[model samples]
Target: MLRVTLEQWRMFKAVVEYGGFNQAAKKVHKSQSSIHTAVHKIEQGLGVKLFTVQGRKTQLTEAGEMMLRRANFLLEEAAKVEAVGQTLGEGIESQLRIAVDEIFPQHLLYKVLEQTSNQYPLLRIELMESVLTGGSELLQNTDVDIAISPVVLSDGFSEELCHIEFVAVASPDHALHRYERDLTLEDLKSHRQIVVRDSAIARKKDDGWLGAHQRWTVSHMTTSIDMITKGLGFAWLPIPAIQVLLDTGRLKPLPLLQQSQRKAQLHLIFKDGDRLGPAARAFIGELRYQCMQLEEVM
Candidate 1:
């Protein structure tokens, strides 16, 4: 007879993830004895030991490690099945997992989510924010349902959103102001520049600030902007994020002497020839709508 119960599978995963039956029981709101029994049943059904009892802790055996890997997938699949069932009864009950670069403000994206929630009340949304390259990698690996990145998609991927402007900016109190009237390519070369080391953007092999003799690299766009605002460095910021600074006479935009200065291209990437899930397709539709609306306003 089939012996691996859902409770046992859940308890097994909790033990593997939480490190012990006691902790897993506390997390899952079950007694330690119940947790132990569930795991024992799982191990017995599989005919393999799941955990090796250390003095005061439990560690996964090779068999346990393998099971732990599959356990996560199984659990996720089970949740999706339940979600699908719920969807059939009411509406789309699945989730959309998206990876986004830090360049886009969460507050702005929240509006999109709000619209989505109203349209699909049963849909859940999760967002993972990272740099452009990291988000792209997550999309490539199918770890996320969608990725908003700043790299043009090609080869194995296809584009969903496009056309973003990137501009070079500096604080008014910074040294770049010295060349306010005489800002030549040569003058720009002698200064230190703050640059974003976006993993995906870097792969484009761009020489964005070729004029700068000294360059400092940062991973976060906000951090780079904060440093620039403090007169610590100059950086390239998206036109929208730096618009306020420019309007308030806090930051100055540099003329792109060469095409290299115009390096950033914001894009939405996904697997080529792939059909997006209902939630994912809905998210993409919202994104496209936002892009079109923003384009008109901009």
Candidate 2:
């Protein structure tokens, strides 16, 4: 059997990584002779020269370079194992599941996740994108640790995260834009309206104007916005999601006599606010910071 110990592999890596056995021993708090002996054992066991003297400096052979790369990957995995243990010792959870409303800014979520990964590399993340009351329902059932939605739960813990602007919009060429005066609910009744279904299984809600005789209901905000932007129907959509499209003239606001836009208060909720883990708390802070950044860009 070709038996190779971790100590031997580590010595190989240490010599190449720290540029010399003497330096590697100093960094790892071991004597230079011990590191040299370990490396010598590895070379003899494999019957190959791992390092070659090039002038005054020691250089790795091709086989040594390949082994060094593989060693790095193993060391990284070992570091992750250690990180998980350390975090758990500090009362941090192994995984954080967060439920987010479909209307929330997707870019902001990406930014928050990017930052969180840097801060907690070993923590696992599970993100659920829900529509309307979907996120709130998950919170009620204890399916997620954090819930970010417009619906405020009556119990547990909740705090206002941010305000999302829902603007009534349609394709630029839609019939609603042909009107000479401010449109009314009666005017909207003549056309088709795009409606997004509430994601809650039991507590579904009938939100916004449903006066239109012809309407199409979709399960996601993307589908609803796609239908409206394609001139299939008109509906209110969150500006953070469609601001670029709106700016590019793909959609226009309905000339409503009133209520052209509505501000929805989004809140962050935790099942046990007082007992939240370190990772969950850090994620909430990242969420708030990223949302504020998105607001400035929007």
Best-fitting candidate, measured by TM-score? Answer: 2
Query: 21-129 in candidate 1: lDDT tens per residue?
Result: 8889899899999988888888777899888887988999999889878878888888877766878675443677888877764556787788887877667688887
| Candidate 2: count of backbone clashes, pairs at least 3 residues apart or interchain | 0
Clashes of 1: 2
Best model per lDDT: 2
With candidate 1 superimposed using the best TM-score fit, by how many Å does residue 5's alpha carbon deviate from the native? 24
Weakest 10 consecutive residues of candidate 2 by summed lDDT: 289-298
Which regions of candidate 2 fall more than 4 Å away from where they truly are? 22-29, 46-48, 54-57, 107-118, 286-298
